[model samples]
Target: MQFQPIYYDGELLLPKIELHMASCQAIGIVTDVKRKQLLMDQLVDHSNYYLFQAQQAEYMRLTVEELITFLNKITERNERVTSLMDYFALKEERKVKIKDLSPSKRMYVTLMRVFFAHQPTLVLEEPYFYLEEQDRRQLKRILEDLSKEKQILILTSNLEDAMISCDVIYRLNEFGFYPLDIRDSEEDKQEVLEQDQANITIQKISTKRNEKVILFNPPEIDYIESIEGSILVHVGGENYDCALTLTELEHRLLNFGFFRCHRSYIVNLQKVREIITWTKNSYSLRLNTDQDAVVPLSRSKLQELKALLNI
Candidate 1:
């Protein structure tokens, strides 16, 4: 299905979107919240699309089993509630009212409506944002199964979540919409290794935008994230494709106060203003930037970070 260009507030939110959803595979569009909302709204206007929005209304008064039964009855499906409960891994909580379940569990139960959807195309918004790991796996599995017969479209603000279930992924923002290359081949792995063997020759990190190479000084970079075998150099509020591996960039930017904070992230310490402790062991570094960027600080690296700052 193709959508015409969309504009909101005199700014283009999306260009011509031509999407051909393949069967047995989910397609994801990694976009910002506003754009995701806009796209979802447009999908809602289409009667052939089944939109499963985040925090969609649920039967809070009904027990988990009752809710599933009601959905089955209304959809006129023959699948028994017991099997559905087991498939959703809700057998243990079947008797619990939707309101009594935890936020994650409730959202998981609410998502059951998708499995019974009659639409030929299913569109979901941030399906993994509020889910726990176990629930995420279950949902991914169900979506994969559903994709065998239905065209699935997942709209998420997170690339990681999209990678979990999407066979093909695209990124859309103000800069423009484009496909993200998440595939890793032997050549790509060799290139990374070859980069690791090279010494830092320059301080300016090279990145690409719109098929043009752009060099950035280390200080101007907010952080570098390695996502699904792709290196993204983030600056200000935008990100660009990077050819160099994180290890090479880390070695090049070490003299400029960049810290390898996580397995997949390297942050510019000069931009870090707060060490947020979300849990006893989970930590994040909040950047002092206009966009309020935050990156995860691995548990194993916390002590090293504290030692570096003399905390």
Candidate 2:
């Protein structure tokens, strides 16, 4: 018997890509804004796929709870409506209108609401920008779950953002879309090597206390914080003033499990005990130490920290 493929209008757009999506594939298209919009337009205008643009998509102006209730009606109770809502940590915002929610929250609701409503092949544009780390993680989970029966076409210019939940990545060139040889990329190889190396030596950070110099192992420190004009290095339960700049330390400890979670702090990912979400938007990292130090988390770098920590 001859095999049939999913229709992309009368003719296929990017035969190479269409052929690969014989089954649901989490595909990433790396391109600039103009090219991304062009692809989205083509998909919406010509294809049978559902396009989920965060800003432009139409989601019924329902409260979060109401949306879940509505999703249950469309795709049946089998749809993962409540779990998805919880995954995005939207339980507290159940009373607010979907339209009135924050940009990031609204984006999550729109994407999931559309999915449950149709479970259509998704063509998402710049889906990763402005997403907090937890939101991105939940989105990754959603995409992975949906990929079992739905094709996901993610369009973005940033490589790291594209790498989130994409199984196959294509680079858009002047000629056309081409496969990104990630395995052959030197930068990727270096990153893999760094992550693989188990033993990293962190001899010390030079410090001046009582007008005397001291050396301490970087791993022994819980975190580094910038206070006033001096850098404070937090050891087990005590703090010491360090001479080297935060930037310098970050560069040196990149191979280790250290991450600059915020502008004023660089944390040891190994010591991060838990991520506390104080508000819908605010987050902090609690460390596993005697003093139980807490470090500020940058909303922007949350995803980066997750990637580094493999959480």
Candidate 3:
């Protein structure tokens, strides 16, 4: 006895192909080198004229190397090219290994989706996966920078990083997409106010007379020194001890006139009375209060701060 085989003929297959092509168009698919070559081969196959026509009508094939070269030519900075190259490397590595791509590449692809997709809204899940601490910070900066260009929707479980990076945050509970928090300049101001209130409470508790406070409001603070995990906020004539870590203080006071000039210090921008070029790679910040502090500036941030201050 012969067995009959289940089959999908041209009628059924055409609809499936159309649906797949539409899905691919919606999401902006990126094919690896092998898949791209296979697509091209199928497009040129005389036996599958329908597939060939579909490929020609729906998509274009380009090598990752060619795409990198094109991007390098149009991009202005060496850093952008470096980032693109890193992404290309990871893409190739993933093809060879058939495993998870590097976090940097994943970030790059997500960014590309945002750039190329027609939709104004995009969502990213677990974006920080496989990234180093420094890379994660860089990714946050990149995302923050990109937000100026487009509205992004990110779904992340990392609360601290999300707080640092997002303007508005939401949580998924039984109620669905609850607005958990909104952090903007106002939040930053409230944080500063709460910090000041806490400081007042501490002073009242300790009765420290020489403890400092801000007499006149400044545009920005350059750096605050960290002593034994506590931040020393230098204002008019004295140092005010605050029970905040240097990073936390920087985040809280950044909108109020503080900038992270070093890992251990955050400075007031308006209080930067003068900047002494300490060396080719470093500088010293002189405050309006006649106090000087040395802070290490990375080459990139040094240029950025100079442009920001117009110094």
Candidate 4:
């Protein structure tokens, strides 16, 4: 059925609105505050019955608070009386409420619509554009969770982001939108294997101080801390005190995951718990032990560190 036109800023309705209007028997248009009132005024004076009928289906444009209230009302109605449940079960679900949904919640709602409503065609526009990395990962998981339930059209400009999550990608180029690439997610397993191989070159430098002291495996070394011109190697369980300068340690462990982050300290590439800015010219490294190491990060080193960490 035709859904209410939900407009953001009144500039345009999402492209899916037109498709829904063509397929559904009824239509509802939801627009923002001033635009909704303007549309309501136009509909009141218009004699076009078809337009008015469509406008009548326009459920009130709900604010975030109002949407919460409406959801509460639905739950209350469902719990209150058996007749209300029966009626709701018999009728086509007519309610459409849009609010500022968290990334996880939005994915959950999309999956619910795909499964319960049997919506054959679904369109999402940069749904995770504003989400943080962790939240984006959760949303990606939800998309994978619902992959078999419906046909989805996702519009995004980030090819790498899309490739990580989507099976079939249609890229928009100067020529026009086309299926630029189709990837079997199954093949992604092989890509991960290649990534593991890429990391295989990180050599393991044995720490020697009167005896052979091997730090934990490459991944277990969170980062190295340099203090008083000496580099301290941080591993999974303990810190290895080394007698090498930050530069010397960087030279020796460069093939491994050691990077020079500051003048006082060169850090183990893997042991970096967090990077903290003490000031514009200075920064400190927070280790896995929760101790803060003040280190001077040059502009060049900051950029290099970002690239190394993929941040």
Candidate 5:
């Protein structure tokens, strides 16, 4: 399916997207809630798409096995409920009512619709967000197996969640949708390298907002982000377009208590209030800000950050 470009008051919101999803690949799009809703709005009215939203409603009175049986009956799938329950690792909770399971387990049960969806494309929103590690593993395994038969598209706000199951990942923001390089292999890292060049000293960052140029001192900035290859200067609670590249910004901000926390993010160490470990490798830096700002921290950089802060 093809999606035309979307614009808002002369600014580009979403670029034209052409989907080719028949390669047994599960595509993941990491985006904010509003954009995810925008994409969902376009697919919700279509019959060829099965949209599994984050807050999907379930029959609270029905048991897990009953719900699976019902879905199989309605979808005309002949898969044995007992077999599916075992495959889903829900045999222990098979007799438990939907409302009785833990929040994580309940969400996992709600995510079972993907297995029975008749639509040509399965669009799942944050399927792993509320799931526990075991449930997450089960879902990832299920999604991988399902990808061979249907077009599976995952939409989530977390890159780490997307990385869990998706074969191909894309980042969608106001700038445009672009593929992200989340590969851990050194070969993939080398593919993204640029030729080394001399850097110049910079004190203030120049950004553009509403056709007006705004200059912010290095100390005033909270973090710098790279979205779709566009540098954005984030200050206070707002972001402005920056002409400089992330590498350039890194060089400029290197001496201002800033750390390259992730491949796409740079954070001011002075503002880092907490190091939130989602997993041993997946982590985030919570900033000491009023709006509860957080940034992704790469596992490869964790040791570097520890040394920088003497932690």
Candidate 6:
């Protein structure tokens, strides 16, 4: 997808990273706060070539149902508000006022409305900020659905968020946007393979419940998550404290389908029913267990997880 060389205030912004309008979802990681703001202005503000500014773009100005009715009157194409609500998991908060809604919730409704109006492009600034893990996953799915016909540009300082949502990614800097390395290097791949083959035995894991130690098989554990320096193991719809850290367990259980999905979580891929979109920055893997457990997924590991799941 080659784009015409684009310039912003006499600086090159495109062709360094080509963006096509055919269902393209692109993300730019700008760690520098100043650069991120500058890039946002360049992408979201109107230009000679890209005239649709973010503020001028369509967004939710009314309730979900009302917005749908309004769209039905203006556009020739009919879009269902019920479906949009379901897609964004807004069924529970359908009646909530826009002011009463949380930041993440408001963002979800904004995204739904923007896409329902069939806007050709969406320019978002730090879209994943403060989003919960579950909402992040839903937003990812929504962007994917919208990308079939619309272009999405996400600007954020979080690299993982960019990796999760964008088809083509770049880093914003003083020079311009530069393509980022998303693939594991050859040496790193070899190291992963060697690590995968070397240790396959993790017969049992020890955990304490109420200060009583219990042992469980590696296969019996659904997932392991670490929160705030404390490691917890999930098995049989229960959580127990494990002596081993997430890193230690991830290495021991690699052959057992346990993969590091996030910095705080290692999941048994075989138990994952589906990947839940939390936001553009975060993800969740829903387990097929009795409790329907979910594990955190990091943006940086998005491709690795997809490859592992064969998605």
- How high is the CA lDDT of each candidate model? 0.83, 0.68, 0.42, 0.43, 0.83, 0.65
User: Candidate 1 versus the native: TM-score?
Assistant: 0.69
lDDT per residue, candidate 5, 207-250, as tens digits?
99999999999888898888668888889979999998777777
Local accuracy of candidate 2 as per-residue lDDT tens digits, 23-76: 556888877776666566556442457777747653647798787767677667
Best by TM-score: 5
Per-residue lDDT of candidate 4, residues 19-71 (tens digit): 22222211122223343343333333222211211111112354333433344
TM-score against truth, every candidate: 0.69, 0.50, 0.30, 0.29, 0.71, 0.49
Tell me the tens digit of each residue's lDDT in model 3 across 176-262.
Answer: 223432221211222333444343322111112255333323342334565446556555445566565765555555567567665
How far residue 180's Cα lies from its native spot in candidate 3, in Å, is 2.3
Provide the clashing-pair count of each candidate structure: 0, 0, 14, 17, 0, 10
Residue 143's lDDT within candidate 5 is 90
By summed lDDT, which 10 consecutive residues of candidate 2 come out lowest? 183-192
Q: Is candidate 1 or candidate 4 better by lDDT?
A: 1
Order by TM-score, highest first: 5, 1, 2, 6, 3, 4
The better-scoring model by lDDT among 3 and 6 is 6
Candidate 1 steric clashes: 0
lDDT, candidate 2, equals: 0.68
- Arranged by lDDT with the best first, the candidates are 5, 1, 2, 6, 4, 3
Q: State the local distance difference test value for candidate 3.
A: 0.42
Question: Cα RMSDs of all predictions?
Answer: 7.2, 14.3, 19.0, 19.1, 4.8, 12.2
